[model samples]
Target: MTEVDLQEPRRVPARAAGALRRAAPALLAYAGVRALGLLLLAVWSAAKGKSPHTLLTARWDSLWYTRVADFGYGWEVRLPDGTVHSNLAFFPLLPWLERLVSAVSPLSYGDAGLLVSWLASLCAAWGIFLVAELLYGRRAGVCAVVLWAVLPVGIVQSMAYSESLFTALAAWSLYAVLTGRWVSAGLLASLAGLTRPVGAAVVAALWATAAVHVVRDRKLSWRMAVGVLLAPLGAAAYVLWVGHRTGGGLFGYLDVQGQWGNGFDGGLAFARFVGDKFTSFPSALAGLGLIVGVALVIWLYVLCVRRGQPLALLVYCGIVVALALCASGYFGSKPRLLLPAFPLLLPVAVALARLRTSRSAAVLGGVAVASAVYGAFWLNGSGPP
Candidate 1:
């Protein structure tokens, strides 16, 4: 073959092999933790006469996604209380994947969603490890992956949710940005924007990084300018399309979210919700726990800033936290929403990396069991997950 053909064929496999070698250990550990969570969930569901598969694939947001796949959007519920719950509030990427997977295979939409989510979670874990490894080292990367896997809401990573898919896109996009691959970074960010509202964090981070590069170097590269241009297209397209459909113009999507009682309220709604919890002794304890959780999140961000994490990571993480915590919607979903904010775990990962291997493993093992139990309990509870 000619030199050009030979070079193109040889490059891809070499890069894939190198990435596999670098990420193998982290990926293996991540798989192990997820497997344990599934095992515990299965046992718990069996005891309660519930189906584990139903919990993972046919409930809450998963059900909405499958419905969108089965019957293309335009679905809405009008409650007697005068509230509108519309499937249009959900972004289209997950349902599109579910539809595509179901069309190509014998699986149902729910099955396809679960499969896509499980696979995307592996990709997400791998991307997270690569980012941590690039910043710290392989050991810290492994610790970061473990920390994420042992989160109280970690089981959501394995469920038929958009969190895993969005995270995979976000992590890989951040990695691309860190490595100065502008076009790839922008493309990934655009895909992420199509996945979830938090994708704005990725787009903002890319813009912030590119702006810093241009200002510091006193000139803008064509690649950087193109990346910036591509970053917002996914979200803009979807929002504008929704506006056209609703005939409400630019604010149609926001109107839909408002109908569902979801909006950015500067944390006033969330604070009132927490404050109400203090009226009873038992609920006061939960309120105190909420305070501690918020404080911990803030402390970790300060540590990240003091330790000099990359500007892209900080901005991405800051926006994710702000949106999750400040939103006026379901209080129970905040932890799950925060799943994509993996950089907050880095300071913890760094500390874990300093310990002996055996101790670190033991710690992770204990937390993994606790997380599995908590996830099972959380899902089994009467409230929505």
Candidate 2:
């Protein structure tokens, strides 16, 4: 063979190996946590005569996503109560990926979705590690990934949902922003916008950071200008398309969500939902749990602010929390919606970094096991919708 051919063959494998080596730590942690969750789910589901894989790959929102993948949009279901649930409410990127992957492989749309979510979750973990590593150190970065994996709703990361895909984009976009790679950040932010509605959080973070930089320097660089201009296009394009298709003009997308009883009421609906939980004696405990959960979320954000987390992370996380807590629909789905707000765990990661290696490992391991059990139980019962 010619010298060029020899070098090309060697370079491909070498680069692949190097990339895998670099990502091994985060990927391994992600795989371990997800495997534990799957294992527990399998055992629990087998006992209850349910299909764990179906739960992960086909139930709830996963079904909607796959439906969008198999058949293009414009699908809706009307209940006997006259409520209409439209697939347009779901962003398109996840289903797009599902269609692309299933077209090239033997996997069904559901399996393709599972595959996409699995790989995206690992990418999300690695991106999260990079962000934490940039802000703190490698130890804290590892702990941050561990903390994310052990969160109560972390199991959703393994399911066929947009959270992992959006999170991977958001984390990498924030990392790019921190490193001053504005174009890359903007591109990722755009892709995130296509992945989930909260992708606005990423776009807002990029815009806010760019604005701060301009205010400080009294001028905008060409790259920053391009990035700022590019950040919102993905979401705007999708919304405009939806509007045109539904014949509702600019408000068509909002109207679709409204039909499903979703809207931004500034948390009034959430407050009433919580209060209603207290009407019965047993539900009173559930209401108290909701109070404590909200309090904890607020406390962690306060800690992040006090610790002076980077502006990009703070902006992204704040918008995520606000959207999750303020949304009026699916009160039971708040925790799953908050799964992308991984930066909120920075405080816990920093605290874990301060401990001895053995102690941190022990704590994370225990939490991983507990989270796994909880995930199995949660999925077997009435889990996130």
Candidate 3:
């Protein structure tokens, strides 16, 4: 009877492990946060008299993704001057996933994108939590996930953005690299590359970390080298294909991006734009605020580097930020676009971990409520500029 009693508690059977894996505590916490966020999204849509489904699938960039999934790629629309704009500009992984889901589920292409991104965001939160736990501790991991959940830019997670999906893959891939699971890291990094252009950054981080390990060991490791080689294939192949179709080299896709006002030369042009904004009282105040915000971002990077952050994390965050900030086009979306850069959460995570539970809960609660309201406002077109 005593043996039975002990075995009962240990009866977490091997087959049941799958369910437990899916019900990860971190994932549950992530879901609670995202559910609150979705509530805000719903309220905002109701106020605008826009169906959340439509908004999810029909918005600015979502439309492009849906068209790509529904009709197929290679369909181009021509401007008056006979210039062609193809949907090939966007990466394939998101739409491809959408197609796969729609084939097996009742969800439409647009809704599928929303579903995939929403789920992927939760996965990202879990992955980040795992990384923090591995590096710091359980408390730090929890804090990191909470910070990500209530981040000022949380609204993007519910949108049709690729940030969440890329982040999930990148975080777990980096975690795998740290744990010396080279093949797994390479696989996840490859998927990340398929998800977004910045995936190359993750690949670079992995390769760099592996190289350091190899050099320190003073011997060549085929596993590490193979992992490094596998990282860039997905992104590189897609970009090369885009170049072939667009009648240029890799520069062709970049040229197409420029036509959409997204040329990447350096951040000098954006700095000049912000300088012009300082000419008026209101603009000056706003510009000053923007400058302060940028400074905070820079300060966080400095803190991480100075604190002797892990090399992989530092490089990953640095490359993502540099690419986003230095990209000449779409200055307005810089903040939103850089949401996938996960390393920025480290300092805040570290701080939160040291706080007492009561204090941490109070702070997270306030941020959660405010984030909900801000998300609603953004959706309703009344949010901060």
Better of 2 and 3 by TM-score: 2
TM-score of each: 0.96, 0.94, 0.90
Give lDDT tens digits, candidate 3, residues 1-385.
0111100111122343663363376577667777887787797788788776665567767778888899887777778876666787788899999999999999898889998999898878877976676666677778888788887768778777677889999998877776677777888898999888889899988888877776777775777777888899889988888899888897877777766667667789879878988899998987897799788888989987866667778788899988888888767778776787777887788788789988987898789889878777676663321
Give the Cα-based TM-score of candidate 1 against the true structure: 0.96
Q: What lDDT would each prediction earn against the true structure?
A: 0.89, 0.87, 0.77
Show model 1 residue runs off by greater than 4 Å. Answer: 1-14
> In model 2, where do residues sit more than 4 Å from their true spots?
1-23
Between candidates 1 and 2, the one scoring higher on lDDT is 1
Per-residue lDDT of candidate 2, residues 10-96 (tens digit): 112224466456557766877898899999999999999999989999899999999999888978999999988999999999999
Best by TM-score: 1
Model 1 agreement with the true structure over 108-201: per-residue lDDT tens digits? 9999999999999999999899878777778889999989999999999999989999999999998888877778889999999888988999
Looking at model 2, the pairs that clash are: none
Candidate 1, run of 10 with poorest lDDT: 1-10
Error of 3 at 343 (Å): 1.0
